[model samples]
Target chain A: MGAKRIGKQTWKPEHPPVIISAAAVVGPFEGQGPFKDYFDHIYTDIMAGERSFEAAEKEMLLNACFTCLNKANRTPQDMDFFLAGDILNQTISSSFSALELRIPFFGIYGACSTSAEGLALAAMLVDGGFASFVLAGTSSHNASAERQYRYPTEYGFSRKPHVQWTVTGAGAALVARDGEGPRITFLTVGKVQDFGIKDPLNLGAAMAPAAVDTMVRHFADTGNGPEYYDLIVTGDLGKFGHSLAVKMAVSNGGFDLSKNYQDCGLMLYDTRKQDVHAGGSGCAASATVTYGYLYRKLMDGELKRVLLVATGALHSPVTCFQGNNIPGIAHAVSLEMI
Target chain B: MARDPKRKPLTVDQKRYTEMVRDLVPRPPYLRNSLLAFLFGGLVAIIGQFFTDIYRITMNMSVKEAGNPAVATMIFIGALLTGLGVFDKIARYAGAGLVVPVTGFANSVVSSALEFKREGLVFGIGSKMFILAGSVITFGVVTAFFVGLIYALFVF
Candidate 1:
C-alpha cells in the first residue's frame, strides 16, 4: 500500500512510521534552561571542546545523532538514510556529521523548521519501504548563527525586546518501520507565506502567519479540532509570534487555539530569568524540545496525541540586506502513541 | 524611495494581516530609552571633560591640544571594557548613551577584531577589525571634505 493523500498538503501513510529513539544535546546556556533535565548531554563550554563555533555546532549534531542511535541499540551501519540540516552555510553541520556517520545522507534546509521537515520525509521513506531506519536530525548554535546572520559574538550591539536568542543545541530522532514508540500519523506541508515584514530582527512577527497557516491547514486536513490533541506546539515563533499565531488562527481559520497551545521557543527558556529577550530560537529550538521533552512525554504516556508544527523564516542575510521581506514556512507532524 | 516596480502591491487581506501584526507586536519604550540614553550620554561627556581637564592641568597643554589625549583616553577605556566583556552588558541598557561617544567606535573596532581573530591575524583580525567602524570613518571623512569644500568655495 502507498501513502494516502489527505486534504491539501497533508499525507497519511499506510503504515505509520515509528520514532524509535530521540536525543537532545545542548550547550551551557540551554543546559540552564527550564527543560535542561530532558536533555541527554549538556556541554559546559559553548565550544564543545572545539576551536571554532562552527566546529562546536557540528560536534553537537554528531553527538545527538550518536546518542539517538545508541539509545535504540542501533549502529550507524544499521541506518539506511541520514536526514539532517542546520542554520549554517550549505548546511555544513549536517553534511559534515553525515561524513562521520557514513549513512547515505540527504541534507535538507527549512531554516528552523528543519526537524519537522526531516521527520515528514523520514516517515514517507519508512512507510514506502524505502528504508527500515532513517535518522532525522538538525542543530543550531548561538555564536555561529549570530556571526553568520547578525553580528559577532563580542559585538556591543543592543538587541531589541522582540529579538529572540538563538538556541545552542542539537537533536536527533531515529524513525523506523517497526518500533515501540510514538507513530508519525499525519503530516501537513506548509506553503511559504510572506507578510511583507522587512525587519530581520523581528522574526517572530514575520513567521507567525506561516505557523498559523500550517496549524489551520493541519486541523482542516486531518479533520481535528484544537482540542483533539493533548498539546499543540509551534517551532520558534517566540513570544510575539505565538500570540500573533493564536489571534490569527481564530480570525482567519476560525480555530481557537488559546488552550493546549505552546511554542517551543517559549518553552525552551525562562523569559523572566534568562536574558533571552523574547525566547529561544533557531533550528534546535523545536528539534530539542520535540525530540527530548515531547518525545519523553509520549513515551511515558503523558500525552497520547501531539501536533508539532515547526516554523521557519526563509530569509538570507543577502536577502535581508537587499530589503526583501522575509517569507515564512511551517511543516506539521502528528505524533500518536497507540 | 519609490516602491520597487517589480514587487506586487499588498492585497486587502495581507494589508489587514499586517495591521493586526503591527498591533500585536510590542513597541519599544521610546521615552524610557531616550531618558536612559540622555543620562548615560551625559555621564560619558562628563568623563571626557574630566580627562580633558587632567591633560590640560597636569601637562600644561592648551585646551585644543588636550582634546586629542582626552579622546584617546576615552577610547582606551572603551576598548578595555569591551575586552572585559562589559561594554555590551552596559550597552544593553545604555542604548545610544554608550554608543554616541568615541568609546562606541573603539568598541566596534575592538569587538570585530576579537571576533575575527580565530580566522588568523592578517586576514581575520587586521582586515576585519574595521568592518563596522569603516562605515563611520568613510562617511565622516566624506562629509567633512564636503563641508570644508563648501567653506573654501563660499564662506572662506
Candidate 2:
C-alpha cells in the first residue's frame, strides 16, 4: 500500500521528519572516552551539585532538551511536544523534568531503547502533520540504574564479565516539520523477544535476538538490505550481543552486517582500560553516540545514510527477582541527509 | 548436582553454544579475592573505629551515640575518596573487603554519581546516586519489618 504503512510495523512516511538540531550530554566517565570530543557538555563532579542521583538524571535530561532547542534558536514554547524517558523507577527522571519544560509531554518507558523509540514516534508525529517541532530524548545514570537493578554501590559485589556498564549520559534531538538537517526516513518498531534468559548479567545475549528480530523486520518491511545504509549501529549490545546479532541475522534472517556495523556500548568506552566489563549500555548508549558522534559524521559528509537500532532489555528487579525471563526490544530509525 | 526435572532441558545446539562461549572466558580468581577481602575489610573496620574514637573522645559522645557520627564521617570520607578516584583502586585491590562497609557504600554512590555527572546534575548525580544501594536499603528495611514482626509475635 502506498499509504506509508509497509509490510509490517515499519512506517515509511511520505514526508520524512527532519532533525534540525540535536545535543548529547555525557558524564565524566564518558567524557574520558574515545568519543569525548563528540559530547556537548561534560562535568567533573558526578554530583554536579545535585542532592541525589535521580535529580542529577533529571537535570541531564532537561539540559539536553534545552540544549537541543537552543541549537535551533528555539524555546520550549517553540516546540510542540517533548518526548523523553530514562531507566529509572516510574521514569520519574523524565516526567519530573517534563514538568519543568512545560511542553506537551509524552513520557515513555522502553527502558534503554527510549532514545530510538522517541525518535521514531517524533518522526511519525512530525510526518503525520501532528507537530511542527518535537524534542526526543533519553538518559541513564550509572548509580541510578545499578541500585534499581543490582546491589547498592556500598555492597561492593564483584561484577561478571558479561555485565555491561550503564551509560551515564543524555541525548536530545529537535525534530522539525521541515529543516536543513538529517531527515528521518524510515521507522521500525520492535516486537518484544525473549530467548528464555534468566540471569540479568547476560543482557547482551538476552537482547541480541530482539535486535536481530527488529533488524530482520526492518529489512523485510523496507525491502532493503544492509547495503542500503552507510552505517548500521545498535544502541548497546556491547561486543557479545553485536556478534550474536550478526550470527543470527546471517543464519536466520539471510542478512549480513559484517562490513558496516557498530555497537554504541563498545564505542562509548575503552573496555581495556575502563573496566566496563562487556562495555557501556543504557539510554545514552544510543542517544549520545548517534546524535553527537554519528550525526556529526553525517553532517560532515563522512557518511550518507545511517540506520540506528536502539536495543533494550525489558527486565525489572521485580521481574528478575520473581524469576521471570528477560524480554528485549529494539527500534530502528533511518536518517538521510537532505 | 541434582538436575531439576521440572525445568526444561537445553537443546543440543544450545548446550554446545554455551560450552563454546564458556570455553573462551577465563575463570575469575577467588583465592586472591578472599585474601584482599580479609585485609581490606579489617582495615576499613579499623578506620571506622578510629573515627568512632574521635567522635567519642572529642565530641564527648557515648559509645552508642558515637557510631552515628562515625558512620556519617566514614560515608563522607568514602565519597571523598571515591571522588578522588582513590576508592576504585582500593576497591580493585581490596576486593570484597572494600565492598562491605559504609565506605564501600559511599564509593558506590559516589562512583555511580560521578560516572554520569557530565550528563548534568539532576539526572547524572541526583538520579544515579542510589542505583547500587537503593535496593539494599529497600530490602534491608523490608527484612527488618518482617524480623520485627517475628520478634513482636514471639519475644517482644
Candidate 3:
C-alpha cells in the first residue's frame, strides 16, 4: 500500500478509512427542520445557554465531537488527529474547540465544503498509516453567521430571495483504518473554478459550476457514472445551485444526475415551509446531513454506496464587498459499506 | 496596481457553461417583488403620514419642528412594532421601501438589541444595540454636523 494517487485530482486509497461513529448537534431551528430524529442534540435555542452565538457554535461543535468520541467509546487522548472547520471569522469556532480537545489539530477552511474536505483529509491520513483515530467535523450557527456575513438576525432587514440561511448546527465523525463500518474509498479534490459571479446573494450560481466540475472528474477518474452511487449529494448548493449543477452535469458532464442527486441543503429542510430563503449553507449543512441522515441510511441498509460532492463558495465578506468574483470549489468522497 | 490573487479568466466553454447555468436557474420574481414592495411600502408610508399629520395638528410647533417630532414618533412606533414582532413581518414584504424610512432605522437598532437580550445588558445591549444602524446614524450625524457648520458659516 503506497500513495493512492489514481489520476489527476483523484485518490484511490489502498485501504479505505472506516467511519466508526458520527454525531450531529443542531440549534432549535435545525431541529424543527426535516431530519430532527437523525440529530443527537438540538438545542431549543441558538444560544445553547451560552453568552453569544459564537460561544454557542463553539459549544455545539465541542459537544458533537465529544458525542462522536463517546459513541466510539474513545476518549480525547484516543484521537490521533482532530480535523475541524467553520465559516466563522478566522474559523474561530473550530479553532477554539480544537484548543479545548488538545488533539493534533489540522484547522481546515473550505467555506461550506469543509465537512467533505475534513472527511477526505482524515480518510487520507488514516489510509496512509499516519493516524489511526481521526475526528473530522465542522460547525456553523445561523445567528453567528448572520452577524458576521449579513446583518445580525436582529436587524430585521428584508431577507434576500437568493440568500441562504447558514445552518445552526455541528457534525463530527470518527474515521479509522480498522473498523467495522462504512468506508471511504475515493476522494477527488476540486479545482478552483471562478465563473465570474460577483453577487453575494447568488451563491448557488457561484458554486454550481465547481460542483459540476469535480463531479464529472470523479466519474471520469473512477470510470463509474452517476448510476454507480446510491446517492450523489452536494454539500450546500441550496435550491437553485443544486438545480443548476444538475443542468450542467446533464449537458457538460454527459450524465443526468436527476435520479440519485440530492443536495444536503435541500434534504435538511422542507423548502416550502421553512423560510430558509435559498436553502441552508455553511459547513454544518453537509456535515450534519452526511454524518447523521446519510450515515444512518447507509447503516440501515437503505444505501450501499454514495458519492458526496461538497461544494464551497470561497468568498469572504471582504471579497464580496470589494466587488471581486466568487471562486468555488468542490470535493468528492465516495463512501461504501464494508 | 495588480490584484493580490489574480485568478485566471474562465475559458470560452466554461463561460458558456456559466451562461447556461445562470439561465437554467430561475431569477427571483422581480415583478412580484416590486408589487409587494410598492403595496407594503405604501401602507407603511400612509401610517407614517398619519402620525405626521397628527403631530402637525396637535403640536404647537412649526411644520419643520413638527417633522422632528413626527420622525421621532415614527421611530417610537417602529420600535414598538418590532418589540411586538410585527415589524419583521412588514419588512419581509416591504423590502428596502420600508427600510428607507425612520421606522427602518428604529427597527435596525431595536432588533439587534432585542435579539441579544439573552446575552445580558452591557455588552449585548449597550455595545451591540446598534450593530446595523450605528454606522448609518453616525454618518448621518457627522455629515449633518459638517453641512450644518458650513451653512452656519454662510448664514452668519
Q: Which one is best on lDDT?
A: 1
Worst 10 residues of 3 chain B by lDDT: B1-10
Q: What is the lDDT of residue A256 in candidate 1?
A: 86
Per-residue lDDT, model 1, residue A79, is 97
DockQ of each: 0.57, 0.15, 0.40
Question: Which structure among the candidates has the greatest TM-score?
Answer: 1
Q: What is residue B137's positional error in candidate 1, in angstroms?
A: 1.5
For residue B138, model 3's alpha carbon misses the true position, in angstroms, by: 7.6
lDDT of 2 at A120: 95
Residue pairs whose backbone atoms clash in candidate 1: none
List the candidates ranked by lDDT, beginning with the highest. Answer: 1, 3, 2
lDDT of each residue in A1-338, candidate 2, tens digit only: 54888988899878888888899998899999999998889867665568877888888888888888888999999889999989898899899989999999999989888999999999988988999999998999987787678754434456666788998889999999887888999999999986766668878877887898898999998998999999999989887788888887897688988999889999989888898988888998999998889989888889989999999999997777766667899999999996
- Separate clash counts for every candidate: 0, 38, 0
Against the native chain B, each candidate's TM-score is: 0.93, 0.84, 0.76
Judge the docking of candidate 2 as incorrect, acceptable, medium or high: incorrect
Name the lDDT value of residue B131 in candidate 2. Answer: 76
The best candidate by DockQ is: 1
Q: How accurate is candidate 3 locally (lDDT)?
A: 0.87
Report the TM-score of candidate 2, chain A only: 0.98
Model 3 docking tier (incorrect/acceptable/medium/high): acceptable
Assess the local accuracy of residue B71 in candidate 2 as a C-alpha lDDT between 0 and 100. Answer: 92
For candidate 3, the chain B TM-score comes to 0.76
